[model samples]
Target: MVAFAVEHRPEFSALRARLDEARRRATVAQRSLIPAPTLYFGARGERAVIDPREVRPNAAGQVESLGSDHRSILLAADVSLALPVFDRAQAARARADVDALTVQENLSIEARRVRAEVGAARASVAATRSSYERWRAIGGAVEEATVLARRGYESGQVGIIDSVIILERIARGRIAQNRSRAEYWRARTALGRAVGVIQ
Candidate 1:
């Protein structure tokens, strides 16, 4: 039951998720200490005027170069890497580690709480069941007395006052029995809740 509560409780699930996220953050921070290479790629176009001496007159009397247009495209690629001269991620890693530890402790505390709750609920159920059974027995005895009182009164062997008193006692006994039964059911419900079986 303790294990079931820990595994199925929403609070525990949330804590577990938080712990996982904290651990992931810690790992990322630790890895960040290792520098990674960054690659860059670029392209550019450039235009340059041809020298007057290189220009020639075309057949249509227009100035044109002997080759194609004086435009050029340049492509460049480079990779940059850091040497990790300083441990810049140390503080972040430490913070993440602390957060993970805190969450782990919280989860442990919550599990302990659930265990205690389950134990208390079980005790309550046992106590209430015992009380209910005892009350039921008392109620049965009271019912028998009521029946005898009624018979005596009908046969004129018992007075009205005594018969009235027995009837009242039976009523009170039934009330007590009903109350005990309700308490027993309530305790069972609480036990179910503590075990995470009652949502």
Candidate 2:
């Protein structure tokens, strides 16, 4: 029953999910401490016109000629990484760790609560069933006495008042028995709820 409750209870399942999410966050934070490299790819095309007549004279009086028109295509690839010099995700990791621990503790507390409820429900069902059985036995005995009283009254051995009294006792016994039966069913329903068998 405890296992069923833990598996089926919505609140418990939510707590478990929270714990899992916390653990996942913690793992991500821990991995963030390592610097991840980013790859970049770029391509460029250039078309330019250079006049040959545009010559220049150097300091040594030598003539320098400008190249002709040309087209160039450049493709580059590079990888960049940011060093973890200042922030290593320490604070985030710490927070995730704390959250995971808190959720774990809460899950444990919930499990204990479920077990306690199931135990109490089982005990209640047992007690109520015993009470109902006892009442049923009393009711049976009262019914037998009522039959005897009716027979005596018919034979003129028992007075009408006495027979009426016996009938009233039978009625009271039946009422008590019915009440006990209702209590037993109620306890069973409670047990079902505790075990997560009922909504």
Q: How many pairs of residues collide in each model?
A: 0, 0
Kindly list the per-residue Cα lDDT of model 2 for residues 24-98, writing each as its tens digit.
Answer: 989998887555544455555566545657778778998665665565655444555554454568778889999
Worst 10 residues of 1 by lDDT: 76-85
Each candidate: what lDDT? 0.85, 0.83
Question: lDDT tens string, model 1, 1-199?
Answer: 8998898888999999999999999999978846654445555556675767778998899988765556555544455555344566877888999999999999999999999999999999999999998987677677788889899999999899988987888788888889999999999999988988887
For all predicted structures, in order, the TM-scores are: 0.65, 0.64
lDDT for residue 21 in candidate 2, whole number 0-100: 94
Judged by lDDT against the true structure, how good is candidate 2? 0.83
